[model samples]
Each structure stands twice: as structure tokens, then as C-alpha cells.
Target: MGRVSPPVLPAACEVLVVGAGPAGSACARTLAAAGHDVLLVDQHVFPRDKVCGDGLIPDAHAALRVLGVHDEVMDRALRAAHVRCVAPRGGHVDVPGTLAVLPRRDLDDIVCRAARAAGARFAAPWRFVAPLLDGERVVGARLRGDGIEHEVRARWVVLATGAAAPPLVAAGVCERRAPSSVALRGYLHHPELAATLRELQIVWHPRLSGGYGWIFPGPGGTFNVGVGLTASHASEEGGRASMREVNLRRMLDTFAAVHAPAAGLLARGELRGDWKGAPLRCSLGGARWSRPGLLVTGEAAGSTYAFTGEGIGKALETGLLTAAALAEGGDDAAVRARHEAALAGLKPRFELYEKAAHVNRLPWLADLVVWRARRSPRILRRMSAVLEERQNPGRLLSWRGMTKLMFE
Candidate 1:
């Protein structure tokens, strides 16, 4: 999170986008391409390291295509045509597609460059402090950098600044509390594992509850390994916490030691990196996305899917939708209404994913689904299509499908 920007901040812009990550970058590119004077701000410079699984699955590929950067991204990635799902009960499923793997450092830089190429001005090493308001409406943002305060006015403000949601929280747009889903990951290098690893592998053990462990292979003998789980109390029913408070460092250590996929790596693999953990804000807490001239997107808007731990694709989707809404070009309230309507169209699928996340608590259910996925190509394809956005995510929760997977 480091970059140099001009000492003097611009006085105004047509659109002020906070955060230069996927959501902000994508939004800026779309707006700039449509000929808007855009200003994108962030605390870090381009190519900064971030905690992520970094798999741009089919859905992400689709988003990049819309942004006109698909070819650029795919060209640099170590392509994997499939994501291999492995259940603790010895069943596995392979969902094939165009999946790209790269570190978030490299990926974010690629998208950010595209944003600039589209003519969006970028200001980094500048942190967002709060929203500048005109009574109840947001008209600009207050920023702090180089040990001084600066104000940049704009017609509209978008908070894509992620989990902290500082602007959103400071202005009473989002809840002023931290999200509960915490996660950690790191890279490991094992010659044997690297030589043979071809697809992303997800391990669904009963212990992870709403989350899973993943071993994603990349080029050059490196593996992106991580573990994630929500606090049980954060579940849909909101009961007492069942999973104990975890020390991510130790949990990842133990998982790598005992979990089959990483166990063998203990002796042969080198500790190529240290553990990096962060709180994952993957659920919308009834966040008021827009109020007057202010709007929120990306993780701040809860775009991440806890069930699959995917945020980049969904974040990109939200960004494009915001750009589309803004392109209609109307009053603040009108544009917001349009954006909300478009996001609402996705509620059904997201709700189903929430239910599926709750259902993941039952090991037997995961095992049955995996067992069938192993034997049934159709079941595997259905699972794959959901992430690809080619089918309804809710289909996995259907009564008929459940009955068939368990008994048929």
C-alpha cells in the first residue's frame, strides 16, 4: 500500500471514486470510457500485496471482457481449465472452465492500469478520512496524505474502499462495526505438488463449518494455500457460536500438518511465506448503499460470497453495474434507484448462497453432494455453472436436487 501522488489535490471532478482496487478501478474505467472526468483515490500504490485466493474464475473472465481488459489479464495468468473440489469423505468433483490464477498484487495493478488507460486520474498514498457533506447530501471527500488535509469536490462519491468502510461508517451509511468473517492464507512451495497441481482444489472438512481450505496451484512451483470460516454466531439463524475462536496462524499450521493436501508438503515444501489474515466482510448488513449523492460498492457493499470466498468477480460486477447506473445520467436519487434495482435482481442467488453456507455446517450433506458430484457429471457441471454465473446458485438448494443427490 504505497504510491506517490501529486502534492496538490484536484479541486473537483465529475466523479470521485474511493479505493483503487478492482471495484474502484473497474468503476473508474467504465465512467472514464463514457467520457466522465474521474478521480480514483487509494491509500496504497499499484501492485500492492493483498490477502486473496486470486482465482479469476469464469465470472471474473466475463467481467473483464465487459471492461475490455480480458485479453490483457488472461495473457499473464497461469491458466487452469478446472476447479477440483475435494471433500473430506474422499469424494471429488472437477468443474471445468477458464480459470486464471495470479497474485492480487499483479492483478490489481493490471486493472488499475486499465483504469488509467481509460483516462481516470489516480491519486494514491492518500487515505480517505470522511465525506464532505452539503446538509444531508455528499458533495466531496476529505483526504489525508503527506501529513496534510485536502478536499476534492465531485458531483458524486462512491466508497469502494473495502472492509473498513471508513467513509460509509463515518457518514452513517454503513454499520460502525467490524464484520465477523475472518480468514488467513499464505504460499507454499513443494516440487512434487507443483509439478502435478493443475487445478484449484477446495477441501471441505466438517471443522471449517461455513468455510473451506484451498490449495490453488500457480506457475513456478508455488501454491496459494488458505483457510477461512465464519464465526458460527454470524450464521443465518444467529445462534450461539459453535466453532471456537481460532488463531489463524495456528489453524493454518495445523491444517497444513494434518490436512491430506498439505501434509505431505511439511517435509518437502518450504515455508515460502508467512501467514496473512484479515476480516472478510462478505455479507451486506443492510447497508444503505446510497444517500443523496453518496454510494458504496465493492466489499464495502458486501459483494464477497462467503460460501465460495470469491469477491473480485462480484466486486467487478457491482462496479460495472454502478457505472451502468451512472451512465443513465440522472439526479443522485434516480441513479441510486437504478443501481439498487439492478443489484436486487441478484438477491435471489445471493440468498440461496447464504442458505447454502448455513447448510455447509452439516458434514454429511457436503459429503453426499461431493459423492454425487464425483459420480455425476451433470451435478458437477451444475455446481461449476453457478460460479460461472451460467445457472442459478439456488438450484443446489432445491428439494428435488437434494433428494436426488442424497438418495439417487
Candidate 2:
């Protein structure tokens, strides 16, 4: 990882982007390419690890194209992916997607560099202390780094700070709320696991309620494995049991016991300090994403995919849309309307997926549906399209084709 000293004194730029993650970098790069003076800042340094499955779906590629970083991103991604779905009966379904795998450390570094190359100034290891307000309007932000504080002034401010929207939300620049689910993930270096690099496995267990466990391979012998559960369900009477420390441990043990009993791949890999954990916040509702001179993108605005817990693609897309909207130069009311419109267009699908994830509540019925779909290629295709966000699941379910599925 590489760190840069923070700037001192008040700074001025046409745009100030807080958080240098995918969303922030994408916004900065797009605006800078338009010849706008842009500044991007993050609390962490380059090459820092972010907890993720490290898998990039086709939609993610689409987002990269919009950001104009597709070529560079393609150069860094693992070209193909093999997906395996483990059913409750221990049966596995192997599906394939035009997926790519890359570590966040490397990906974020590439994106930030690209943003800089596009003429965006960067301030890293800089803490966003608060938003500098112009009385009901955000003028800029007061940042601190390397024991020095500086005020950055900009005509427009973008919040791409991921799940924690930071001082902007906390300072009342935007309304923020907690996610519906929290995730815990870790990395490991296991040659045996690496041998399965081409195959990313998703284990659907009844124990996880609405969520599933995943194992995704990265470059070298590295792999990421994690589990997530709905916060609302996990906070109930027995909800606390689903926390990573408890349920995750049991799930991992069960997986290893059933799949790799003789070799103990997970136990051996843990001895090398190849594991870590972090939280994944679900998209929450009621976050004030835009205001006069201020706008929020990515996880900060709860734009993540509900079922798969995927945020990078949504974040990138949100960033691009936000930059385009801001380019139109609107008043507070106009910007807020545009922001809300963008979110409204996407929120329904995410909410639908979230609802579908709970189908596990009826295990036998859900399994039967999966089983039937597996046998019918047409049904599987439709289901897959729905999952990929290509079609609305609600409409798909309401279709005549699905009606036949119910009878048959």
C-alpha cells in the first residue's frame, strides 16, 4: 500500500470527492475527463484490502465501460469464471457467467491511478472531519491528515464514502440509515483452494435463512470466503447466533467436513494469517442522497444489490449517473429530483431480489422450485436473467411461462 501526505490549509477545486473507492474514483475520473478540476480523497492508502468476493459480473464490466476504465480493468481481471451452486441436499449445480476475479487492493489502486491520470488530484490517508456548510448548503469539507487540517472548497461535493456516508450524513448533509444485512469475509492462501480458482462455489444452506456462503478465488493461491445474514432476521430471538463468530464458524466447519474432510484445507490455510473479516451493509431506504451542492453515490446511498450483496457495479453506475446529473447544473430541488429518480428506477429490482431471497423460508418448496428450474433450460435462462438484473423478477414471475411452471 502507498500513502500520501494530506494537504494543509483550505483547498479549492471544481469538485471534491470523498472516499477513493470505486464509486469515488469513477466519479472523479469522469468529471476530470470533462476538464473539470476534481479532487478525490480517502481515509485509506492505495492497495488496501476491502472485504469482498472479488468477483466481477458482466454488469460490472458494463459499469467499467461507462467510467471509461474498461480497458485497464480488463487488463487486470481474470477472464473466465465457473460458478457452482450447492443445494441443501448436497447436490451442486455448476453455472457459468462471463465473470472476472480481482482483488480489491489491486482494483482500487488501478482505479485511483486512472482517476489521477485523468487529471483528478488525490488526498489519501485524509480523514473527512465534517462538511463545510454554507448554511443549509454544503460548500465543501474540512479534512484532516498527517496531523494537519485543511478546508476544501468546491462548487459541487460528492459523497462516495461507501456504507458509512461519513460526515456528510452525520452532519445532516444527507439522511443515513443502517443496512439490512451485515457480512463477514476473509482471505486465505491455499494451493488446494487455488486449484479451484476457475470454479467459484456458492453454498445455499437452510441454516443461513435468506443468505448463502461463498468461496471465490483470486490471483495466485488466494481465495475469499464469507457468509452473510439478514440483519432483521439475525437480530431476532435467535438472531445473534448467525453472527460470523458463531454461525459462520459452524457453517465453515460443516462445509469442510462435508467437502474436504480428509485434507482440512481451511484449517491449514488459517495458520498463515490469510484470513480477515469485515462487514457488508445492505442497501437501506430513506437515505437523503442529494441536496444543494451535495450528492451521494454508491453504498453511501444504499445502492447495493440486495440478494447477492454486490455493490461495486451499483456503485460505479451510480457514480457515473451522478456525475452526468451534476454536469447538467441544477438547483437543489432539481438535483434532488434527479437523484431520487435515478434511485427509484433501480430500487424496485433490488427490493424484489431481497424478497425472493427469503424464499428459503419454505425450504422444501424452494428446493422443488430450484429442482424444477434446473430441469427446464428455458426456466433456468429466465431465472438467470432475472438474477443478473436483465429482467424484472416480478414481471418474470407474473409471466405466462412462469404460470405454466406452477402447474407443471
By TM-score, who's the top model here? 1
Off by over 4 Å in 1: 1-6, 231-244, 398-400
The lDDT for every candidate, in the order shown, is 0.77, 0.69
Error of 2 at 196 (Å): 4.2
Residue pairs in clash, model 2 = 234-239
Error of 1 at 202 (Å): 0.5
Best by lDDT: 1
Per-prediction TM-score: 0.92, 0.87
Model 2, span 1-408: residue lDDT tens:
345775543368888998888888988998898888898988887768787777887678888877677788778776664466666666665555667778888888888888999999987788788778888888898888887888889888888887653554555744434345566666666777566556777666666556667777766676677665554324433332233234655655555555542125567765334445444545545367777778888777776766667778878888888777776766777876887788778777777766655543433434555676678777667656764667666543333534667776
lDDT of 1: 0.77
lDDT of 1 by residue, 265-380 (tens): 55567767677887666655436778888778887887777577788888898899888888889887789999888777766666666666754566466677777888888888
